[model samples]
Target chain A: MTYCVGLLLDAGIVLLSDTRTNAGLDNIATYRKMFLFEEPGERAIGIMTAGSLSITQTTMARLTDAIEEGDSPKSIMHAPTMLQVAEIVGGMLSDVTSEVSAKMERMSQNATASMIVAGQRNGGPMRMFLIYPEGNFIEATADTPFLQIGEHKYGKPILDRVIAPGTSLADAEKAVLLSMDSTLRSNLSVGMPLDFAVIEANSLEISRRRRIEADDEGFSRMSAAWSEALRNAFQQIDPI
Target chain B: MTYCVGLLLDAGIVLLSDTRTNAGLDNIATYRKMFLFEEPGERAIGIMTAGSLSITQTTMARLTDAIEEGDSPKSIMHAPTMLQVAEIVGGMLSDVTSEVSAKMERMSQNATASMIVAGQRNGGPMRMFLIYPEGNFIEATADTPFLQIGEHKYGKPILDRVIAPGTSLADAEKAVLLSMDSTLRSNLSVGMPLDFAVIEANSLEISRRRRIEADDEGFSRMSAAWSEALRNAFQQIDPI
Candidate 1:
């Protein structure tokens, strides 16, 4: 299981992804799930993937291969807008998923994957999308300005109630971390050393990238604070 | 979709269930998912249902019928121990599920249902069980002292972090309400007018049952407070 979230905020985009991947309980491993594509001042995109590692890796490889094909790259870097970039990523992910699912079927296994792609291009608005396994996608709008992939439900409540387009970039990042923290507490399959990134609006450059480990002091502090607040709130409620 | 949760604590047990039943987004109606059977001071059983409403309703009716059986009451009141009561409920629920599934299959439908049964008999220890579609069930233990059925993921995080065998009964109730509150916010398929019940250890009877409506003031206040805390926490975090 994986938990990757992307938020579209007034100031920028915040992206976070867990690094744990497992074929079975005993076959756990850490694999970075976020991929960054940047041409410095030209374009910057961050993708956080979940589901089948095979499909996501392949899709991301294809995207990178295209970016490197820069005698006029035809990937997200060269796309006219973020929407087109989403279309390209969606198509690539879907294709890879179908191919991997077919191979996994031979062993009676299942292939499932999805990706969260967000960034700013030279000429387009900073955008965020939840690209499904089927190659179709939906963009974040003002009303619901964030998208999540992989083991989403455990963390969805916080996202739904608090995230919006007007949310500050700082708040948005905290929201995604808290959301991820929720998932981490509930699911053993999703462990840490997280991959986090931020892309300032109109910057056309990835502003920040972080690898948040399990023992990271900031995260530990945040979790403790949240738990204390919850305990406090629970005590305040009128008893039955 | 339904959301039903049961917590086994030193103080006793807490059972919570939402009442909304929907065939799809457009067709929804209210139906209580909780049923209580108490031969006060002798025993108290709280059955919270999720999944196929038809199968669950039938299962609940069967349990009630068994309790009212004069000659051979396969009832919680008559059972020698809490475990016996669990077996009776599990067997009946399993039987009803298969019968309904067979009938539904003939009409091109599916039968999927699950339940959380929490109860205590006068001479037995308090136990909470999660009965599966197949009728097999598992009791909560010290390490995992809670079970949730139907659309569980959305509300699971809070429970995972907050619930424990030693958790105060008052805290347990608040934990579940907050959990239900989270599920309600994220999954449209799971809705309001929830039924929440509490069983005090060794009391052999339910101590409280509250019906929280869509506009329940306490819930609204609690949600508002939670959101504010989240926002405040976000603001407190040092920006990256």
Candidate 2:
């Protein structure tokens, strides 16, 4: 299980993801689910993945390999536009999923994954997309400016209420974290430390990147505060 | 998609269910999902359904028929204990599900449904059981005094945060309504009007019952208040 959320706001893009992965209740492990691709001023892309670890890891490795090959059409760094970059990632993800699912077919196991791709290139707009396992994707628009993957429902109400295109980079970060906080409380599978990143609009660079550990004081304080505030809010509603 | 939740508290039990039913987005209708049985002063049982409507309807019908037949062992009203009442409901639900699935098997359609059974008999302890389609069930305990079925995740966080065995009946009512409010906001399949019922512990009868319509002023007020309070709560947390 995993929980990853990405927001494409006017100020920037915000992405957050948990690190826990498990094959079963007893086979739990922590694995980084967020990948950052940066060429400093040239381009910066953040990819947060959910679903099969094998498929996502392989997809990430292939994307990195394509980038290291230098100026290849398949490399996201050299892609002409953010749309093209999404196409490349979606294509690679679909291929990896098909291959993995084929191999696991005999065991009746499913191998599929999806990703949130958000970034900007030198003169392009800050854009974000949710890439599905079938290689298809959807872009975030002003009306719906956020995308979430894995263990999403428990945390969705807050995002549904608070997020919009004009929301500030600071508030967007808070919304995603509080959203993640709700998920963490209800679901044992989505664990910490968390990987968080923000890309300022038009910057073509990752402005802020953070890894929030379970014991991190700031994250703890915010989570506790959110819980207390929620209880207070709940109490404020009149009983029918 | 549907949403129904039941809680067993020291004060009694709280049960709530939405009235929406749909075959698909285009094919939607209103259908009651909560049924109450009370030989008032003797026992009070509330059965909330989710999943296949055909199966649930049949199960409820059979239970009603058995009760009307007067003192049959299969009749929940005649069952010696609340556990036996659960068994009767579970067995009927499981049988209906199997029969319906057999009829739908050629089209590869599933016909399973689940239920939350909560109430108390004249001499029995207040109890609530979640009955699965397989005719097996699990009772709620002090550690986890709630049961939910159908599109449950969106509504779960509030219940997890606020509900406990010692919670007062009024608070329990508020918790379930707010929980349903979250689900209604996130899921189009769970709609209004809602059916709510409460039974006081050791009373052997329902204490309160209400039908909350879409225009129900008090419910609308609470829903609006909850959204506003949540936004305020979200703003109160410090940004990282």
TM-scores of the first chain across all predictions? 0.94, 0.98
> Where does candidate 1 stray beyond 4 Å?
A72-74, A106-108, A237-240, B106-108, B237-240
**Share of native interface contacts recovered by each model:** 0.41, 0.92
lDDT for B115 in candidate 2 is: 95
- DockQ scores for all predicted structures: 0.50, 0.88
Q: After superposition, how far is residue B31 of candidate 2 from its true place, in Å?
A: 0.9
Measured against the true structure, the TM-scores of the candidates, in listed sequence, are 0.94, 0.99
Pairs with backbone N, CA or C atoms under 3 Å apart (clashes), candidate 1: none
Interface RMSD (one decimal) of model 1: 2.7
For candidate 1, what is the total of clashing residue pairs? 0
lDDT of 2 at A144: 91
Question: What would the per-residue lDDT of candidate 1 be over residues A59-103, giving only the tens digit for each residue?
Answer: 888888887886444577778888888898888888888888889
lDDT of 1: 0.84
User: Candidate 1, fnat value?
Assistant: 0.41
